[model samples]
Target: MSVTDEPLLSVDGLQTSFYTEEGEVKAVNDVSYQIDRGERFAVVGESGAGKSVTSLSLMRLIDDPGRVKGGDVTFRSTSAVATLARKFPEGVATENSPGYIHVTELRSESGAVGSDPGATVRDNPTDVATSLHDGSLHIEAGHVDVLDASEDAMRELRGNEIAMIFQDPHTALNPVYTVGEQIAEAIRKHLEMDDGAAKERAIEMLERVGIPDAEERYSDYPHEFSGGMQQRAVIAIALSCDPALIVADEPTTALDVTIEAQILDLLKELSNEEDVAVQLITHDLGVVAELCDSVMVMYAGKPVERSSVEELYYEPKHPYTVGLMSSIPRIGDDRERLDTVPGTMPDLVQLPSGCSFHPRCPYAEDACLEHEPPLVDVETGEPVEDPDPAVHSAACLEYTGELQDGVDFDVQIREDAATDGGESV
Candidate 1:
């Protein structure tokens, strides 16, 4: 499917922090990216890179200590009318007006403009009100700034419009409830289907996710399913509501190689078949290569590199991204040990003075240690205040003409690159 004119999800200058007695740990700082409809975007980095925290902040799942300090997350919803009706029951009128009103024009009871019960969203006609029902207004589409949405509005959107597939299925799934019942519960709540209808839809979703004997497995609990099956069940629940975006946080991390491939294939198939956008968070570059079209490499809670998968793999601009690509094992490797990025991520509370990765960077220079670099366009080599998702950019002193001897790297291609030479990691 072609990408829509408007992006499905747009995040700008997102800053999330965790307050502790020691100090405030900036888990996600100035993270921004966009996901178009049916686009598969990958966020890859080492453990403390704020990949998961970024996703959590987007979902508004951050707790008290860990709050989203600043940022804007705008989402385009498919079922805006129903969601808004449920969110603002009092605003609904019995009068059947067959006129279209832009979502931004329809104010809540508090007279606040936007879909939120109390918050605000930008004025845009992307979402148009279609008609008014017995006690609800029907909207064809809508845009919502989730940050401004109230808790109740967020609850209506969470399972209904945006769904998350957590890393561990064991914790995501309710151990006491049957897998089918869990899926049915989400269908009933978000979809407003009856008991029988929800149960049938749940079984269908189970089958769609590749569960064997879904009918028989309906009554089975989480313990009854294997690791892979449990993960599939979680996927079924996430897909039950047909969310526009699915944030899969290391969905295959806990499964074995064989099962991991199955899960990856399933996700790829579902994303294409369902035409659902995906925000895949994983540390594995191999998985990113297989499933993602666009890639963002995050380091120290910031996007160090952003580009198409092919461009990122062939011509990585940032040293950190180059190091990550170099660490991946190739098909014909004779080295005793694989190359690894030196040193761990720095403490977020007290980051390095200049470039956070300067201490571990191989080509670091005096300029790199003295000044931080903004994301620069790869072609123009100019700094970008607000990056465009489609543009290839990297955060490196070399990009900004600060490094004396610039970072050097090359992608070697063998003569017989098709069969065995140009194998992806």
Candidate 2:
């Protein structure tokens, strides 16, 4: 699962919503995107723009009331799980080479053990301790609808294949467990590693993630470490199995700026060297510009613009996107005020009739308030071509010939407030 030129994961028509006492809040609507092997795809938006929810939805980690309304999250694999799974005999994970059995790969279909994707098990392999942490039960999900993948498959798939670096390390890392213990537990669960070996590997991973005094500090509780160190430890846990994809949801949220820079550097380095694709969910456009290869601008739970990082920054086509760009402070630039989108993001429960962003968009008109524009290429106003990395798509009425007064991208320097008041003596 190193580097390949194929799309490792594709999400289509994803709809996620939260049910409240008042009404259903659609957090993600018709979201679709894909990340190729080793690509760093970023999802950027304001606080409630559904960046985090989209990531959670991809991982099937969304909790109750926040159900996946409709979608397909297909994972492409080349029989890796099945191949390694064959090494297990009667559910007992073999002591020798089993490529990597992330979370007990209890055979999916025609359950059997062998070093082949087509190997059939004598029976549903659950009775094998590999099947359960218990002997009385069995678990398996019959489909790839990640939201509904069997509890066993998901448990293994999580840390084994797709791992997540959550926003807060404090809540993410168990307070009661020793830092090393948690990492070792994950390693043991996903890999065919014994206790002693798993502990050693955990220490190694901790060191690999740049934690200092790794061996000695393994016994320390989460509270014992500094903020940066805790975050490093969390990264260690996520990388324990060398997952193919990592969903980093504001991984730098709590850290100081310096620490945040270090974390981002580490993630970028890992993605480049290890060929691990990252789904970075963030509110910082600067971070997106710096770290992401491609960027998706989410607004009101829908993707309004998507393009390679360069196009998104310099050739932005969406009005909301342009406003966001004008908000970024430039070096050695003198401006009285930064551009801001007026009004707040809409309420998802009662999202505006047409385009949710119409209320805040400067270019919006009656058509924008009545008919929502689909995500289309800014130049052609057509569906985006998969191979065109330069395709800049935005959901804006201006591109669709519906916005009477389109966006004005001209530079308008306002008079300095104090200066406009009159000369002072």
Q: Model 1, 294: alpha-carbon shift in Å?
A: 0.4
- What TM-score, to 2 decimals, does candidate 2 have? 0.82
Q: lDDT, candidate 1, residue 404?
A: 81
The worst-scoring run of ten residues by lDDT in candidate 1 lies at: 117-126
Error of 2 at 405 (Å): 2.5
Error of 2 at 161 (Å): 0.3
User: Worst ten-residue run, lDDT, model 2?
Assistant: 416-425
lDDT of 1 by residue, 309-365 (tens): 878877788989888877877766666787789999999999998899999999988
What ranges in model 2 sit over 4 Å off? 1-5, 79-145, 385-390, 411-425
> In model 1, which regions exceed 4 Å deviation?
1-3, 89-141, 414-425
The backbone clash count of each candidate, in order, is 1, 5
Best-matching candidate per TM-score: 1
Q: Measured by C-alpha RMSD in angstroms, how accurate is candidate 2?
A: 8.7
Error of 1 at 199 (Å): 0.9
Provide the overall lDDT of each model, using Cα atoms, as 2-decimal numbers. 0.80, 0.75
